[model samples]
Structure formats: structure tokens, C-alpha cells
Target: MSIKLDQVVKVFGTQRVLDDVSLTIAEGEFFVVLGPSGCGKSTLLRLISGLEPLDGGRILINGREVAASGLHLAPEQRGVGVVFQSYALWPHMTVAGNVAFPLETAGRSRSEVTRRTEECLATVELTRFADRKPADLSGGQRQRVALARCLAQGASTILMDEPLANLDPHLRGAMEEELSAFHKASAATTLFITHDQREAMALADRIAILWDGRLLQADAPEVIYRRPRNRHVAGFIGQGSIVTVRVTAAEAGTAHVRLGKAGQDVACVADTQPGTAALLLRPEDIEACGDEGAQLCGRVERSVYRGGFHEADVAVEGLDAPLMVRLAGRPAAGERIGLRLRSGWLLPA
Candidate 1:
């Protein structure tokens, strides 16, 4: 099912939790809402799911108005199944019982509940543990049970609010795979919310980032990473350094920019307006090259080992702040090195 929000606004006391938010989730698409903590990521989910009242704007599910002005549909009527951050499983019930509970509550016959429960359990690969209590299951298994319940509900639209937050790192990765597979198999319009950038990148068909109750951006993962709209989006989506650059020239499909007072020039693959602008460079975008071969030269100020790579902070000659560069080999603290941004996006100043 397709879902749309038009100029949605939510406020609490004097705080505006969401402001003039509008978006559309296409049928059978996996969309993710991503942001840092307290950025109103969860609030947007609640608004869409009919769990919260909106101060203004409209919500449409399958082109039917669900929330607008004084009209608000009940959560159950929205035909949206929500898997909360807590999973919200019944503590005293077995996995099968929990999965079947929603169906039974909806007036489905006992036979239908049993059949749907079994089908959902199989979908999540939790059939063998159908009769087992949630407490007896591992964190991942418990998460699967929650997912299974959503499946049992037969809702074509699913809203997931950090359902894997309680799991450890390893389990989170495994669940991410399972959730993605489920999304594909079911072909549901899924809107997942999370604060984790990696989780958004890993699971989303497209990601929408929220900040201070404002929607900063919404785009395909690669586009958001490589061509962020502004400094805020560029800085938040990845580990990147924002450097000021003077746009010296612009063409039909690219721009030539100069960095620092020395006029170190580089070509950005964007049709940017010519003036002062910002350049976003991820750690991997900067290469450690020979001193004479690279566009910018710097001294290695710090190098810290991090698994397969070293996060080196370099003191560049013309820049005031240390430019972070990721390298496989660590350079000495005082070693002079050459640096060049292999690629970056230029944002209007």
C-alpha cells in the first residue's frame, strides 16, 4: 500500500517535534526514517501509525485520508502492523499464542489463527519454537517472533520502530539480513525507523533523515552518501570533513573548485553554482599519496588503529582543522604526507 503525509506538524508544549513534514512511501517499498536521538524519528512513525495526534497536515493510507484536521482514524483501522522497539510480546504467552492473539482479536476463527500462526512461524523460521515461551528464546528469536506476529496480521504495510535496538551488534547484523529478506518476500510497504546510520544504509531502499524536527533529506542511500544536500546532511550521514571551497568555474555538468589560500584546485562532479561553497569528504575519499603527487600536503598528527585501518588525523598546511584520513598504514606523528580528495560533493554556501 502507498502511504503519504502532507505537511505534517507535531508539537509538544513549546517544542516542535515535527515541522511541515511531507513524504510518500510507495507500494511495496522499504523506506527508512533515520536520525539521531531526540530528532523526532519515532514521532513521525507514531503520527503515521495513527497513534499520535497531529497539530496540522494530513496522512493518507492507500489514498484514503487517515488523519487530517479533526479527522483521525483508529490505529486498528489503518491496516498497518507496527513492530515496536520493545517487540511488545506477551510475556506469559508462547510464540504461537502471541502470533495468533492479534488474529483472534480481529475475530478470525480458531482454525484460521492456527493456520496463519504456522505460516508466519515458517516464514520467520521459528516454527520449531512455536510453542516455546518468549523468555526461553534468544534475543534474535524473540525478534523473529515479533516479525512473525506482524506477518500473521496480514497487513500489507508495516511500521518498524527500532525493533532490533535491544539486540547486540552481532545479532543486529543477522536480524538486518532476515528483515530485508522478509521485506522482499512479503513485498510490503515498510517504513522502518532508526538512529543507526549503518542500519538505515543496510536495510533501506531509500532513507529519510530527520534533524531537530525537520526532514533534512530523503534519497537513495548512495545518493545521500555521495551527494548530500547540505553540510548538516553530509556531516550526519557519514564520517566526513566539511571544508570551505571557492567555486572558480562551473560547466554544464561539473564545477572546478579551489581549496585554501594556495588555490589547490579540484573538479567536483556536480553542476554547482559558482561562489563560496562547502565540500564534504569522507575518510575514505581522502587518499594518502606521495608528497609531490597529491594536491594537498599535510603532516600526520595522530594515527589510531581501528581493526583493518588506521584513522589518521592530518594537520594540513592551509586548513585550520585537522583533516581526518583513513589509511591502512599508520604514519609517524610528525611524518609529512600528501593528501587529496579522490571525490566529494560541493554544496551551495
Candidate 2:
């Protein structure tokens, strides 16, 4: 199913939860909406699932209008299934019973429900655990059960509101793989909501960054990470530092910028002009090098061991913010180091 939200709006008393948000999710696409808590991520999912009525704008499913101009369809009529963070399964029901509940409630024949339940269980690889109850399953297994129930509902579009938020770190990693495989087998148009950037980056075909009730940026995972549209997205999506730089010249998607006292050429948008602008420097953009070939020099203010690497913050003379660098070994505080700028993105004015 394809989802299109045109100027979608929601409000609670004096607060506007979602302000003029608009985006189209392609059919069978795994689209993720990423934002911090209380940023209307859950409200967006609720509106799409028909749990909440829209205060403004329109929602379309497969080119059919579902919510608009006071015309709100019920959840059952929308043909979309929602899996929430709590994994709201009935403790008394077995896995097969839970998967078959929706079909049976819809007045389907017993044989039909039985066959469909079996098929859904097989798809999630939970056929062996058919008789197990929700309380008897592991966190990951319970999540899969929730997914199997969604599939059993015959929903073309699946809405997941941080379904993996309750899992342990190791289980969350394993469940990500399971969810990917489940999406492939089911071929559902998935609209996932999460505050976890790692989860969003791992599973999404495209990611939309929502902040303060506004849609800040939406693009492929890597594009949003490398070339964020603004300061908010640059800081929210990944670890990096935004520093003011003077763009001396720009041509062919490259910006020759002066970072403090050192000059370097970095990646920029086509329309970037020569002027003062903000530049985003990720850890990978700065490199430790020999003093002879160094483009810049700084003293390490702090370093933290990150398993295989040491992330050091280097303080240069003229720059206000410390430049983050990844080193193979930890360097002592106040130690002078030679650095080179390999690449960076110039934020648009």
C-alpha cells in the first residue's frame, strides 16, 4: 500500500503536535519516521492507523482518501495493522490462537482461519511455537508473534511504532534481522516510527527527521547522514560538529573553505556560493597525519576509548568547537597532533 499525507495537522489544546507534515511513502517501501520523544511520532502513526482523527489535511491509502474534511474511517475499515512498543498480545492465547483471532472475529470459516494462521506462522518462522503462549516467548519471539498477527490481518500496509523499543540490546540487533526478513516475505508497505537513529538507519529505505512538530528533512539514510539540510538534522542524526567556515571558492560541487587558519576543499551542493557558511565535519573527515603533510594542527583536549578506536576531541587555536578525530590509539590530554581534513559538507545558507 502507498501512503500520502498532505499537510497533515494535529493539535492538543494549545499545542500543535504535527504541523503541516507532508510525505508520500511508496508501495511496499520501508519508510521510517525518526524523532525524539514527544515529537508526535506516535501521533503520526495513530493518525495513519485511524486511531486518531486529523485536525487538518488529508491521508490517502493506495490513492483512496481515508482521513480528510471530517471524514475519518475506523481502524478496522482502513485495512492497516499496527504493532506498538508494548507487544499487546493476549497472555492467555497461544501463538496460533492470537494469529487467528482477527480472522475469526471477521466471521471467517474455521478452516480458513486455521489455514491463514498456519501460513502467517510459517512466514514468521514460528510454526514450531504455535501452541506457546505470549508469556512463554522471548522478547524477540513475542515481537515476531506480533508481526505474524499483522500479516494474518491481510494488511498491505504495516505501521510499527517502536516495536523493538522493549528489547534488550543484543535481542534488538537480532530482531532487526528478523524484521528485515519479515518485510521481504510479506511485502508490506511499512511505516515505522522510532527515536533510535541506529534502528532507523538499519531498516529504512528512506528516513524522515521530525523535530518540534515539523518535518525537517527526508532522504535516503546515507544522504541525510552526510548532507543534512540544516543544523538540527546534522546534530540529531549522528555524531558530528558544526563549525563556521569561510568559503573562498566553490565549483563543481566542491567548496574550497578555510577552516580556522587551514584551507581545504570539501564537498558542497551545486548552488553553494563563495561566502561564510557552516560546515559539518564528521569524525571520518578529520585524519591524524605526519606533521610534514598536516594541513592543520591542534592539541587533544580529551579522548575516549571506543573499543577498536579512540575518539579524540582536538582543540585548534581559532575554532570555537573542538574537532572530533578517530585515532587508533588514545592520546594524552594537551598533546599536540597533526591533522588533515579529508572531506566535509558545507551547510547551505
Candidate 3:
């Protein structure tokens, strides 16, 4: 089912937690809502699940309004399964019992419930541990049990709220792959909430970025990463440098922007009128050079080797902040180096 939100707003007393956010999730797509803590990501999920009431606007499922004008469908009638940050498996029930409990409650026959439980166990590769209790299972296995239970309950859509946050690094990676495989196999519309950019980039077909309780931008992963709409979007999505500069000239294909206090002209590719702008230079786009080559003069303050590459903290003149440049080789302190700024995005200052 395609989920749609139209000018959705949630208020707590006088505080507006979600501010007129609207978005749509395509059927069978891995849709991710990404933002930091207290950004209303979880609140949005709760509203979708019917766990909370919407203060304003409408929510539609399959083109039918589910929440509008203070009317909402109950959580049980939503046909949506929610996986919490902590796996919500019953401690007293065995793995199979946990999976079977939901089906049994839905008025299914004993044989049907048993069959479905076994199927779910096999899907999550937890068939052998069907007789084990929740405390006996590993953290990852317990999570799979929660997913299996959701499946057994016949959920057509799933809402996962930072589902992998509690696992170790290795287990988290494994679960990511497993979740991707499951989504492909099940073909269920998924809404995954996370603050980690790598997780969102790795899993989402399209990402909806939220900040300050508003929907900032919703686009494909690569487009949002490459062409951020504003400084907030660029800074929130990934690592980059936003340097303020003045527009010396403007044209269709290119513009000349002055950088630093001395006003060094840097060529910029722009599609609109150029004025005061901020240039987003990624670390990978900057190359280190000697006194020769097209170089911006800077003095290296410190250097650190990060596995495959070296990062140098260089103090550039006329700029308010120091420039972080990734180099092919390590350049030590007191070393004079030059930076070659290659490709970057220019935003209005």
C-alpha cells in the first residue's frame, strides 16, 4: 500500500513537535525518514502507526483517508507492524510461541498457526531455536524473532524505529543485509527511521530528510547527497565544507566567486544568478600539491592517517575556518602545502 501524509502536524500542549510535514511512500519501496534526535522522526512514526493522534492534516493509506480532522484508525486496524529499538519479544514465550501467539490471537486454527510459525522461523533462519526462550537467544536472533512475529501476524506494511540500534557493529551489518533481503522477498512497503547517514544511504531507495520538525527535502539518495538544496540540507546529509564567497560575475554556464579576505576568484558552475554564496567543497574533491600546480596556499597544522588516506588540517588565509584536506600522502606540521579544489556545489550565502 502507498502511504501518504498531507500537511500533517502534531502538537503537544503549545509545542508543535511536527510542523506541517507531508510525504508519500511508494508501494514496496524502502522509504527512510532520517534526522537527529528530538527531530520528530519517531513521533512521525507513532502518528503513522495510530499510536498518537494528529493535530492537523490527513493521512491516507491506499488513497483512503485514515486520519483527518481528529479522526484516526486504531493501532490494531492499521495493518501495520512496528519493530521497536528494543526487540519486543515476550520473555516467557519460546521462539515458536512468540511467532504463533499473534496468529492464534487472530482466530486462526491450531494447525494453521503452527504452519505459519514454522514458515516464519525458517524465513529468519531461526527454525532450530524455535524451542528456546527469548533470554537464550542472541541479540540478533531475538530481533529476527520480532520480525518473524510481525510476518506471522500478516502485516502488509512494517514500521521499524531504529531497529538495529542496539546490536553490535558486526551484527548490525548482518541485520542490514538481512533486512534488505527480506524487503525484497516480502515486497512490503517499509518506513525505516534512522539518524545514521550510512544506514539511510545503504538501505533507502529514496530518503526524506527532516529537520526542525519540517520536511526539508525528499529525493533519491545520490541526488540529495550531490545537490543539496540549502546549507542545512548539505550539512545534515554528509561531510563537506561550506565556504562563504562573493559573486564577482554571473552567466549561464559559469560564474566567478571571490574567496577569502584577499578576494581570490574561484570559478563556479551555476545555473542561476550568482550573488553572495556558499561553496560546498567535499574532502575528496580537494587534492594536495606542492608549491607548484593550481594551488591555494595554506600551512599544515596537523596530520592524521585514517587507514587508506591522510587528513591534513590546513590554515588558509582570508577564511574564517581552517580547511580539512584529504591527501594521498601524509604532510606533517609546519609543512607548506597547496590545495586544489576540484568539484563542489555552490549555494546562496
- Residue-level lDDT of model 3, residues 1-349, one tens digit each, is 8899999999988889899999999989899999988899999999999999999999987787888995899988888889999888899999999999989999999999999999988988899999999999888888889888988988878899999898888888888898998888778899999998889999999999998799988999997888788878888887767777677777764666666643444445556465777877778767787667745788888888988888877888876656778877878798888777766667643
- What's the TM-score of every candidate structure? 0.96, 0.99, 0.93
> Can you tell me which runs of candidate 2 are displaced by over 4 Å?
none
lDDT of 1 by residue, 1-349 (tens): 9999899999999999999999998999999999989999999999989899999999999999999999999998998999997888999999999999989998999889999899989988998998899999998898888888888887889999998888999889899999998888788899999999999999999999899999888999998998888877888887867877778887765677776544544546545777877777788778988867788888888889989999988887656567889888877998888787776667645
Give the alpha carbon lDDT tens digit for every residue of 7-70 in model 2.
9999999899999999999999999999999999999999999999999999999999999987
- How high is the CA lDDT of each candidate model? 0.86, 0.93, 0.85
Q: Candidate 1 — which residues are off by over 4 angstroms?
A: 261-271
Q: Which is the better candidate, 2 or 3, if ranked by lDDT?
A: 2
Of 2 and 3, which scores higher on TM-score? 2
Clashes of each: 0, 0, 1
From the highest lDDT down, the ranking of the candidates is 2, 1, 3
Indicate the residue-level lDDT of 313 in model 3.
Answer: 78
What is the full ranking by TM-score, best candidate first? 2, 1, 3
Cα error, residue 72 of model 3, in Å, equals 1.0
